[model samples]
Target: NLGSPDERPALYRERSPVEHAANLDCPLLVVHGVNDRRVPVGQARLYRDRLRGLGYEAGEDGDFEYVELGAEGHASSDIDQKIRLFRVLGDFLDRRLG
Candidate 1:
């Protein structure tokens, strides 16, 4: 497992995508679960805001998309939620790669 951020600050900073927002050159799709305990939803918000600060607009036609599932945890188990997640992924890919 990765070490504690407090004890390994350099490693954590190096591994954080938000820390490297300036290096992003492609469209990004960020999907997070609001109930996720492993990785708190705040991280997602930080990343989105970071990208926006770097001039990356977020939307279906923008440089990135952020989706937060209200009832999901780290991994979704509900069939309907899974379908919606897949659809969002597909739509993002289609818009970016199709």
Candidate 2:
């Protein structure tokens, strides 16, 4: 993941996925943990909002998708939570590639 945009403005902007969102030609599925301290959920929301502003539609079968896992941090130690996250990821991959 890229460093905080505040700390490394140029590098952050250069590496940020959001900055390159407009170039995206395929679908995108963004998954974020609500409790993530390393990368706050707001970052994901910002990207989604910006993509929408750039005329990207969001839905399970649209140009972009977002999922927020509650009670989860940057990464989870809970087995069940991991499984659930992976399932969501797998579903996304299947839909995108299917």
Candidate 3:
């Protein structure tokens, strides 16, 4: 009862318990592999976008973050990229969760 008819149930499930706000108290960060095949990076991005729109840091109303590693897939097999990835992740955590 909350959207255009074109929306399928499964697709809408993630948006359930809908939230619409411009500011929230919490924050979040998400690191994802661009080449992920199982859940697809799109889904994670979708979640981030939704949250961002609502004002949660993890969402639009807040400080939500999404990191996509290129040529890394689900796991960073490349040593160089892996090291950089860890450094970025570490920085993100230190700055956000520190």
Candidate 4:
């Protein structure tokens, strides 16, 4: 664990991906589970918003992609969910590195 944000504000600020969105130099893929309790879905949304604020669009044709799985939390257990995640990852890699 990274520790509490309130207890270690500077560490959190320094380690936050959103805080360093300007340093991104390649395609990014952010996948998050809607039911994630360890790291809430809002964090992913915030990161996407931050990237957008910095003029980076999100999608297959954009600089990044954000995928939210409805019935997942922290990790995937269902077969369909796993397949979907792999497909998304594969597509992103193919588009970026093919």
- Which lDDT value does model 4 have at 57? 86
Residues 1-98, candidate 4: write the lDDT tens digits. Answer: 87898989999999999999999899999999999999999999999999999999889999899999997999988999999999999999999998
TM-score for candidate 4: 0.94
Scored by lDDT, model 1 comes in at: 0.93
Would you list the clashing residue pairs of candidate 1? Answer: none
RMSD of each: 0.9, 2.3, 6.4, 1.1
Residues 1-98 of candidate 2: C-alpha lDDT, one tens digit per residue: 66566878999788788899899798888999999999999999999998999999999888988899999999999999999999999999999898
Number of residue pairs clashing in candidate 3, backbone atoms closer than 3 angstroms, sequence gap of 3 or more or interchain: 13
State how far residue 83 of model 2 sits from its true place (Å). Answer: 1.2
Arrange candidates by TM-score, descending: 1, 4, 2, 3
Query: What is the Cα-based TM-score of model 2?
Result: 0.87
lDDT of 3 by residue, 45-66 (tens): 7766776666455423347666
**TM-score for each model:** 0.95, 0.87, 0.62, 0.94
RMSD of 1: 0.9
Error of 1 at 65 (Å): 0.8
lDDT for each residue of candidate 1 in 1-98, tens digit (9 for 90 to 100) = 88799999999999999999989888899999999999999999999999999899989999889999888999988999999999989999999999
Task: Give the range of the ten consecutive residues with the poorest summed lDDT in model 4.
Answer: 69-78
Indicate whether candidate 2 or candidate 4 has the larger TM-score.
Answer: 4
Off by over 4 Å in 3: 1-25, 57-62
